[model samples]
Target: MTSPGSIRRIRRIDLRRSALTGGPVDYRRAVPRAEFDVEAAVDIVKPITDAVRERGVEAILEFNARFDGVEQTEIRVPVEVLHRALEKLAPEIRAALEESIARLRATCQAELETDAVTELGPGARVTHRKVPVGRVGLYVPGGLAPLVSSVVMNVVPAQVAGVESIALASPPQKEFGGLPHPSILAACALLGVEEVYAVGGAQAIAMFAYGVEASATTEGCERVDLVTGPGNIYVVTAKRVLKGQVGIDSEAGPTEIAILADDTADAAYVAADLISQAEHDPLAAAVLVTSSERLADEVEAELDKQVSVTKHAERIGISLSGSQSGIVLVDDVEQGIDVVNAYAAEHLEIHTQNPDVAASRIRNAGAIFVGPHAPVSLGDYCAGSNHVLPTGGCACHSSGLSVRAFTKSVHVVDYSREGLAAVRDHVVTLAEAEDLPGHGAAVSVRFSEPSPVESGETTP
Candidate 1:
């Protein structure tokens, strides 16, 4: 409430008055598809990544101190700081952290696949075993809110994948004395991560990629084999620049959601879910595809009415009205499916009759929700699916975080003398046909003595 003596501006908004809201229940013809342009974000990502490569860690730190407003000599969060976070965190926070540990661990255990072996023939064994990267770096955003869930999303998968060492980084908070938010540390502690960094933004990505300077000796460094998690555009750009040096999950982008609804869908529920994701960021996208013109009209009205009540109303408005987001009124469910596939949204929520059947048809999406009960927010917290997903239409080819992101497969080859003899000629023929005599020589060394002629065998 403003002070009585102070001048105050009172604003009023009624969604029913807006034209964007599908009104008068138009069913005569299919509404035009809402035009979505990807060029805008693509234009931003390239430069951001280029700048990170040219400027290196200094560039990253400048952006962090500039945007995040915390200055520090060292980028890595120290041991003492994380311990303090645990010491000072609230009890209820501890309870939630413990519960999250159990739930997320269960998800990881249930989802991860173990190593396998197959016998190609007698005396020959081919094995596929999951090998964790030697070192992994997990990024967590600490700007608007400390994404405690991200810490779990990243760490749990790495642990399940058997990553030897996991390092997590987040922006230092001026409000919290340049320490990562306590909940972030608590989540880390729950997973037994003693290595946490207070740096943030592209710099955090760089610190993990390039390693931080030693405050003590000023000569030592820490490096990682893979970097994972979601961050701002700058962070995404940094990942792009360092991709060749280290593995990255995906080129992260702004958050997004696409809700497919029918007449049976609750307009209020649809609007609420759309706004819920929109509140994430201005660049975030929220699209609603529906077969029912009536439900579309109602949802449009609901967006306005609902956005007014949310805490981040401006963010919701910007996300919902952004060029990438809008309501697509289709001819029917089939047409709606086509639109959604083209969009390839980060999150796809189906609020149609036989939602399971409709959801099963979706071939591209970072994550999915069925019916009114399963919202994207559930996935953000405790839905068992990793919330860190491919965004900005990246769902077209990418996927959400999972145990597989932390694990790599290394083929194990074992062959007995008989096994080698059985395929020796085949291997030698193919190797020679490839036009490199040295390729065949490696195997020929074993029988270079001409194999005693093998009782009428001839060397080709």
Candidate 2:
């Protein structure tokens, strides 16, 4: 396998000199195609999902042994273990988690919307009421890095939306005796999430979509109404295939960052942010769309200096050199903005003379970090913003995971006798126009007056 340290060169694009139009600057040269083919992945994971659906927990345990290299006697984590993990958590880490929960809670509360009632006319009204999903499954990745913070991001919003039943799943750790990372368990405990599983990847999602049978002390896993959180392509693929069976947040692909900067931006700060996101994975994208060539050159040198000493230096190097990661030189900040919007990065940072002004014009991005003081890393952990966002250009249409993702919007219509009479003719006309006589008959019968019963005495 090629190591990250050997990767030394990152590509650069000069849009100002090229014949590229802002209309559709082909990103084939700049953006790397995702490694996972959802179509092919569908075939690969179909059997696994089928097995889970057929055999339930038995198939889950078998897959766990075959893939994760861990044999679980019991998949469901016990309540006492969760509490113990929290008690043993580091004091500083515990404090930080508490703060994150507080911020997310406060923000989520503000996002909670009330039912909206619209008065079409007297005695005729329509209501848009928001209701929480009954149950949810949160998947936290245990590969590459143990994402303990994801626990807070996924659970808090669901809790705020008042989801009654919440279950969490993470890949079991061999070093930790077939349980998820201790920190993951601890975060779950802190969030008061009692149900957790030692399953990961497609199998974990499968287990959530199709409830597993009761095996050992683990009560049978109940199928969730919705699943939310970021995961690998397989996890994403499972969500895609099982979308109707259960709702999903988004098909989150590889993480990415795009920084729009100018001459006034700090090269060191820009370089550090790019390196920070690159540390995520070899496929992670770190893009720099800047108006200043001097700034780009300086940032490149800064990336070289910064990537060398990082703990995940090899991974960072590979990511920076990948086609997906590069610097794009635009004619000016206006052109740079156009490129960033087209790229639609998952995390977009503005480091220009007037970052707020520049940020205001951005049409698409999962999250915008304004000014040099704000970084994507802060949003990932504690920016009071949900980091579970749309990825792989999905930000153009979809939104980041939030309270809205967990709730369903339903419209309630009410009409009185007078209201029905007023619109009865319109409804009948439309229904007849569509050649659906049954629809018109149903409405016409409601308006039809009952025949007067024959009385013994004649009307006076």
Candidate 3:
């Protein structure tokens, strides 16, 4: 618990103007964000990836000893170890994880895409196919928290997408005798994932990108087609370095939550939600955008009351007071919507007169939580929505992890002789217009000669 005198203050940004004296407001600049520089970390992580590429599992073992301070002899966890972890898991926690898995599995099944065919002409048709990646590497962080829920979030989607192979990696915990946290292992067992590794940091990304060979004491890990999940700076930097070698979900940064509340919103709920995200990391962002000044004042007071007794008071206090966390005072709900869209938080909550209306207008945000009952914490675990999301205004262009991320879209074309004839002149004319006669020749050569079979002639 934090003492009253030591409590940090959350700053305010006033966006309400007396008169219309502006062109389009640059709401992006008005919002606060943490200084997350993945480029700066390239030099530190590149060496680790390069070593893993060159030395294989040997490099991973060396790094595990150096960085994680766990003298690990093997990289992969045995099958019996996974089963033992599950056997030892508490009944209540196991029940909760099972429920979360069921809900997420249902949602992923609903979101799975299917093939679609289109006929452009009498004999020409195209089929759009949804194909799953051959294999995927799911990285779960072991820092601060065990993140057992991450196992469910990453595995269920890849399974739903029908990925043939799935591998998971987490940092080796010294306290857990050089294996991943028992809870994470248990979740993996419950999800029926057999390939698990006790590796972490950028090396895990490199191991997935460049497959390691079998060593004296360890069975090597096979390369994966794609990698997904969240991590810290080193993990994000490694993804950037090895992006072309393998597919990556997103360069996830610190967690963040923004609440767009009005006078109708409850102050206690808003404050508690803000504190919940803050508990994730000291750098996590918690922003409040509202039209009611009185509500703002009440929420601030409620935060003080709540933070004084929370278990993670120091961490929550640091996050709430950081420059990345603050309150934005907008003139009204419309202006509030504009502000939140430009900010593009990872998680956005709408607590207004009509949460549905406010949520509909939101153009950005990795995920939107509507009404008082739908808190960001619910989405983090049991809301059936993915907890892995885009951060640092990335929602403006990217999206959260889902079954779609693990699948690829391919177009298959089928055409007959008559179909080619139907568009021969058009293809030739367009190819000639582009000054590439070879393109036209490829289509022209197919029809230049008639086959005996097509002419219905018999050879003696």
How many collisions per candidate? 1, 0, 0
Q: What is the TM-score of each candidate against the true structure?
A: 0.84, 0.95, 0.97
Instruction: Tell me the TM-score of model 1.
Output: 0.84
Better of 1 and 3 by TM-score: 3
What is the C-alpha lDDT profile of model 1 across 1-460, one tens digit per residue? Answer: 1112321211111212233366543321222222334344445545544554565555555666777787755665667667777777798877776676678778888877877999988889989987778899999998776888889888987888788888888888888776788889877877789888777776667667766445441222376899999987767777776788788999767788889888999999998898888778877777788877798778877776777767877666766665656677666677667667777778999998889988888888899899899999988887777888987667878878888888889999998767787888888899989998887888878776656354467868
Over all chains combined, what TM-score does candidate 2 have?
0.95
Cα deviation of 160 in candidate 3 (Å)? 0.4
**Candidates, ranked, TM-score:** 3, 2, 1
- How does model 1 fare in lDDT? 0.74
Off by over 4 Å in 2: 1-4, 17-24, 27-35, 450-460
Worst 10 residues of 1 by lDDT: 7-16
Q: Best by TM-score, which number? A: 3
RMSD of 3: 2.0
Top-down lDDT ranking: 3, 2, 1
| Candidate 3 error regions (>4 Å) | 1-7, 19-24, 452-460
For 31-84, candidate 3 gives per-residue lDDT tens digits of: 889879999999999999999999999999999999899997799999899999
Instruction: Give the better candidate number (1 or 3) by lDDT.
Output: 3
Pairs clashing within candidate 2: none
- lDDT of each residue in 115-215, candidate 2, tens digit only: 99998888788999999999999999999999999999999999999999999999999999999999999999999999999999999999999888897
Between 2 and 3, whose TM-score is larger? 3
